[model samples]
Target chain A: MSEAIQPRMIDFKPHEIPLEDFDISQRELWSEDLKMAYFERLREEAPVHYCKDSEFGPYWSVTRYADIMEVDSNWQDFSSEPAITIIDPEEDFPLPMFIAMDPPKHDDQRKTVQGSVAPANLKNLESTIRGRVQTVLDELPVGEEFDWVDRVSIELTTQMLATLFDFPFEDRRKLTRWSDVATGGPETGVVETEEQRREELMECLAYFTRLWQERQEQGLSNDFISMLAHGEATKDMSPEEYLGNLILLIVGGNDTTRNSMTGGVLALNENPGEYAKLRNNPGVIPNMVSEIIRWQTPLAHMRRIANRDYELGGQTIKQGDKVIMWYLSGNRDERAIENPNEFIIDRKRARQHLSFGFGPHRCMGNRLAELQLRILWEEIQKRFHMVEVVGEVERVPSNFVHGYTKMPVVLHPL
Target chain B: MPKITYIEHNGTQHEVDAEVGVSVMQAAIDNLVPGIDADCGGECSCATCHVMVKEDWVAKTGSPEEGEESMLDLNPERQGNSRLSCQITVTEELDGLIVDLPEFQF
Candidate 1:
């Protein structure tokens, strides 16, 4: 077992310490307000800040827009192999998914399932997505406050995930459960022990293994599972590899868009003028979709292992050092974006943001994600005057998934 | 609607009508033109929508901006006439525009 590393002891309280001294990796700093403040300070004072120790151990942070782009694009120096999270991979139960892989293999395996999210596929899925979005919105209780994250965001994204894998419709929430377990920590209350998390993920692997067999027997199909079962590169994956890739797709298809869905509501409610502007000009929905992604930054950071010693943004990143690219911070980088703090729906060049990442390993389902958001907002404009934020918002506790856990909202119909 | 021709690297040609104000990338997407990935959904973050503006139309299409150029720089196959379609807004003057999609975009 890898020895559990303890966080470096800090003598001063977080709020009492000056903002410039903040460690961006501290989970407590991830709360919306505190995190934003910390990012603001980093972009101004230290774009490439190094932490001697974190829960994940010593790492360098690329906090500014251009610096992150440099790190993300130069995969030769900063590789994605082994892992992409702050925590090291579980040595006992290593799951080798393509998102954490380097080129050649990563390119091949990613291409295997890339067909499912092609623009052509998105065109076919658009009506189905719209139908589902309308159904969820229509079923929403007007004038009563409810957790939008659960009712709207989770439900809609789960349904889309079910469609992707063609998993049993009734047991679709299993996908959601496994996804949460995959990214969850002990503090999140999703799983108390590593063994428990492993057990649940193994259950997930078993379920998909059955589906894999069924799909192979049925020959080729358009679903993601069938694509993997039939693809030249992925047909013979080991059980662990299969589980790794499945978790990637599930979490990729789920959390990013799901969180963005919730974040869209939160951003709009917080910026009433933007919401009113949206209502007045529904033509901006497509552009606003990109802006929402920028503002939301669903996945907070993607860690890259340095393949060799490298110099970037006035700092040296030694070989094998874990480097974190904070997408949330870069998305708010004033140098890269004008008025980075404000949520402007109609901003020019709205798509120019770091939320989807860049280079070879950028988010595979980016267009589909945008399609879902665009359709949801399109339907929203036709019905609701405003989706009022009615109660306190609870953000996900983890630093990795920058998402809302619960947000009470009431829809005011047009 | 202005008609634009997109030639795939494989020599397959698709002629589609592009709405003014919408992007040429959007026009290709609307027409289901195969090669233009537009993976970032017109973000200009990904150069998946790279197209080589035909020789005759190079002057009309203009050049890629700094952001688009940086994205295109990552594409080894980028040409002198290469433009990120997302950055090029469709307009009446580009009615008969011809853009060749590189094989890599597929």
Candidate 2:
């Protein structure tokens, strides 16, 4: 007798399954083409959904834009203490960053380094970023396929991060690896086990500690490491706190921008008409950058714990209930954005989406992220006629970091 | 191009030509004016670019849109004359506009 064949979960179409059976938290759901289909269905049928059980345990998925805004703004009711992922941070390994803290503490720690990416600082860093971007682009082999994610996005962002920390340039790749390890889980292929993840992150902490001491000896400096070491609020942070904040800065600077960089290329290749529009008028690069970030919607969701009984999206969120605000889903909400699915580079009010998040805990380095993207697009227009995607784009497996692992592309010189 | 004056909270003033059709935030950004953070880059999603329109130019600058107003509400010190510079487009009539920059963008 022939062995019974079982259908693979990835083979199941989202539409084939009943709405009641939908569970968006499954890491497998993020990798399949049905990801968006599931989000679309959730937005239409159950904007505020409850998954009774999943890998990350039962949680409420707020899929609509207005509801997400409510969750983001009402921090008093929805707390971000401990950690901000669907899977709670391990009790043995507590990493406390400012984004996961509440009120006065969050404000104090945030202000410690907010000036680094302030508009004035960004203006100063513009020329340096431009030079680095040019060098990265100029070095790429024209008309030859390469992984744009690694060769361009990761390299450029890692370089910038190294500059921000004043770290040794040759060791810059460690920043990229650390950023990946920080957010990646066992399924992402970046790490095989939770023990391995913790081990790698401890190495990261030790390395940063050495840099912290070195920066302290040099007195105050504009670089992030020195700033944290000197700032009154951040200077005395615990080792765990330091590691948490370092991971925050690394992932914040690395993943979002890098993914959007890859996403932009794929987006343009898929929407050639929009690409034509952008090529016709490179002046639209600034607006198009926002559109790319919006379309990509990196860092898929941020989870918060309900501090008190609260009513949201016509549902009562009981105290201690885990509420996840799916930023990717909200960015694609039909009610919030016009023609949210299609990639439109010239969309008026393009920045109306929620990629950088909203309210007080909104990304501090958002301007820096936008500046990096804007410069890259502006430079791309100058040198390349097109960055042709030559192979299937590989996506990161984790549901948290919605990003590309590899993308083959060949640059076409103008 | 329309000339505009930006008065920082510390009393430093910047006088620059505001490119017609661009937002006030862009003009400040172009001129390196210190206070308009425009962190969301004129998305109307952030109130970092909050400015107090001069009394005479309040009518010309216009009121905030509902979305912009909602974001402005996030600012605890949001005043009657408060306007997100990014939401106010530069026009011929907006020439010689003077706006007071807030002390903190957060």
Candidate 3:
């Protein structure tokens, strides 16, 4: 009989980071080069590893894809009530949204906002989304180098989401800024102090409150806010719940999609041959979109509270414990994916990646995000012959979102 | 075979002959109905195949399961008659059934 490999505690605390300054690139979030190194180590050593006495308090980092899916699917055992992120929610943090709620209530509230992200709704917006993608691509500096992250990816996604919500296009940047402050811990970029984040949160709440009030009074049926304002869920939602959900929708829509765009561009540039494959056969765009999301694995991890004591991957998790589902690691699992390290555009079953998550909490904006990405790739193919990396890509200094802050790309028009 | 009619939110109605064993969602997809994508392949997870049973046929179609009912809450134009079409099998009794596609199903 084969003996079980003796479990060994990997000393990762020598690399422990503050909750605020937890940038993945510093450790490994910057580019695929850095990430692959760390992922390989994690997979080899402790796939379901635990870390103690670090930032965000003591927690388990569930790395393997199968482990993440097991934890995510068994939500009853792995609760979402305590904290949704690695960092414990401060006293001033906004009330929990549906994503943080458990069954029954979570089921009800989630449904209220589901329609806005449903595939049918997304199909209707395809043309407008395509137009927005084209608009962003058209505005790109023809011969000069530009930060695709800011000028192209973020702007294009922000606009698409804004239009879907019927948000005032002029002030849409506020959504991006708030999402950054809300999710941006001290790791990379601007780390908002607790007080500053609270102030920003309150300010955003005030703006949303006014918008909700106006929508209620006007009784318009054109946007998501209006639908939420007059929906069945409104009967039960407190002002805090309403605002918390609005914030979740905006953040959920913004950061992840934005990161996917930036990640896609970086992936293609890094894999020029794959880029050539995509350019040569535009028919591969759909699969390419799946591969990008799989390869990038944006939204690194989602935290879930253990509702009851449960065992996973031979590890015992007590009730009320925290489990971090590392989607980034899962997407690269050697067992689940063939050539998991390589970015193959036509990898069969690439769409099965856990980036958008799986089961009940799967991303509601999946279709819209895919539509925008498809159009963006289509437009880029039409306009540019090659996108050469001109400068260093700046990565967001956080583990939660795998994204680029700046990617200087020289667009060569066809 | 049962005849099913799907009237989109935009008022486009598609009539098709459906076998009793298949689901209304399967029937819609088979006929290339525009709105129902059924991304999850009728698992009731995607909620892409949401449809509002015509008022007269509401009782005949029966209430949705807990999963489908929960999913309907997320539908934008969720009416009292909302049901995940994937969950509703097209039995002989449901012939001439009418379902309205919601304007939005994310």
Q: What fraction of native interface contacts is shared by candidate 3? A: 0.34
Listed in order, each prediction's TM-score against the native is: 0.83, 0.84, 0.78
lDDT of 1 by residue, A1-414 (tens): 223422334343544566445577776566544677667767777778788776678888889988888888777788998988887898999999999998768878887898788765677898999999999999999988899999989999999999999999999999889999999856566887778888899899999999999999997999999999999999999999999999999999999999999999999988989988998899999889989999999999999988898888777888988899999999998888899889999997687788888877788888899999999999988998989999999988778899988999998989
TM-score winner:
2
DockQ for each numbered candidate: 0.13, 0.13, 0.24
Weakest 10 consecutive residues of candidate 3 chain A by summed lDDT? A1-10
Please identify model 1 stretches exceeding 4 Å from their true place: A1-21, B1-45, B52-98, B101-106
Q: Model 2 Cα displacement at A64 (Å)?
A: 0.8
Model 1 DockQ (Cα-based): 0.13
Please compute the TM-score of chain B alone for each predicted structure, in the order given. Answer: 0.95, 0.97, 0.94
DockQ of candidate 2 is 0.13
Scored against the true structure, residue B63 in model 1 reaches a CA lDDT of: 80
Candidates ranked, most accurate by lDDT first: 2, 1, 3
Candidate 3 has an interface RMSD (Å) of: 4.0
Position A142, candidate 2: lDDT:
92
In Å, residue A171's CA in model 1 sits off its true spot by 0.5
Q: Encode model 3's per-residue lDDT on A333-377: one tens digit a residue.
A: 897778898999977756667887755677877877787788888
Between the candidate structures 1 and 2, which one is better when assessed by TM-score?
Answer: 2
Worst 10 residues of 1 chain A by lDDT: A1-10
